[model samples]
Target chain A: GAGVSQSPSNKVTEKGKDVELRCDPISGHTALYWYRQRLGQGLEFLIYFQGNSAPDKSGLPSDRFSAERTGESVSTLTIQRTQQEDSAVYLCASSLAATVVRSSYNEQFFGPGTRLTVL
Target chain B: GIQVEQSPPDLILQEGANSTLRCNFSDSVNNLQWFHQNPWGQLINLFYIPSGTKQNGRLSATTVATERYSLLYISSSQTTDSGVYFCAVDQETSGSRLTFGEGTQLTVNP
Candidate 1:
């Protein structure tokens, strides 16, 4: 596909279980981002991966949340021992570069998102 | 952290009507983009207008960077345009992590 692709459009998991959501960005895009949208809420930034630089995990709600990008391509967000509050839509987006001035952040394309429901 | 606010939390318009959504940020942003989340949960980038005005079809957006406010204009409303329109901004201080508005839920009635 030409756009970002996410797996497991919907997932139901036990509160104690762990879940991993995947994001495949457009081929050759250099920047990737992960965000979460709770019910009736706006998107909250999670992490950002740019080229080989360290990922900025400032928005990660807790230590239990971690993500990694391989070769500036596929990225995965893992929630360990998921809590009910973790239930929400996990969104993935990829951009061409950092600032829109020179890089045209317009490269950022969003995926359909994976809906996780914790029971 | 910068504060972002969107007005008219909800709006209902008849097809072919025009409407505007506003987003106000507490600080200046060099990066601002408008997105539309369709009913099917797809986030479509409407415009990456950080400043000035940009138009595409029936949609147009303007961002007053110095004033810290942006507006999205939708002309000729259609059922397909019924969805949540989000305004996201990235403060250079934040390193590209977009801070999004609560969004304006627009409903177009036939």
Candidate 2:
């Protein structure tokens, strides 16, 4: 089975530019999540999408950051007017949703992640 | 919002040594997971032990939900085990969201 996949493994953009990172979740995964990791720091939750329900945007740092998931498959995180602070690795993960809970939580699998550098 | 804390922010061990990593959460959680981020920055699920205990090869984890803590144990470690170990929890308030700890950076030398 293919794991989660992210595009633009590495990206370098000038400040004030717009960048979009794409994520293709595992087939049949109903839950998708985006996270950001700064150098030497832990990952921060950015957004989450489940099935056809409304997405959770509480973790978005600011208005410039937004994410969208079409159906239950692909998701894109767009950062408008990229800033130097946005330079980090954007990781995507997916799970089988809450329906199948072998344990108390849905185990999430991650992608290679996209490293964004804003100059 | 829940707070997660991992002990021994950094650790160094010789190959074949045993080590224990601990995670403490500020609130009760229904989902507790342990992840190992490899050198390539890919997060590999180590355990989904929200409670009780689970063992896989040389790794094992135990989560005491009532105590709000979890422990990950690695025995006879190898150089390939060098990476960051993170503990994440999904508390009742967060409802399906996971709060991650700063993580423990482990370096295993052969």
Clashes of each: 0, 0
> How much native contact recovery, as a fraction, does model 1 achieve?
0.64
- Give the TM-score comparing model 2 with the true structure, all chains together: 0.96
Among all windows of 10 consecutive residues in model 2 chain B, the one with the lowest summed lDDT is B89-98
The TM-score of candidate 1 is 0.96
Interface CA RMSD of each prediction in angstroms:
1.9, 2.3
Return the top candidate by DockQ.
1
Model 2 per-residue lDDT tens digits across residues A12-65: 999999999999999998888989999999988888888745457798999999
lDDT of 1 by residue, A1-119 (tens): 69999998999999989899999998878889999999888999999989756458899999899998888799989999999999999999988887556246544679999999999
Interface RMSD for model 1 amounts to 1.9
Against the native complex, each candidate's DockQ, computed on alpha carbons, is 0.67, 0.62
lDDT (Cα, tens digit) per residue for candidate 2, span B19-98: 99999999977688899999999899999888899999999999888898999999999999999999988776566677
In model 1, the runs with Cα more than 4 Å from the true position are A100-103
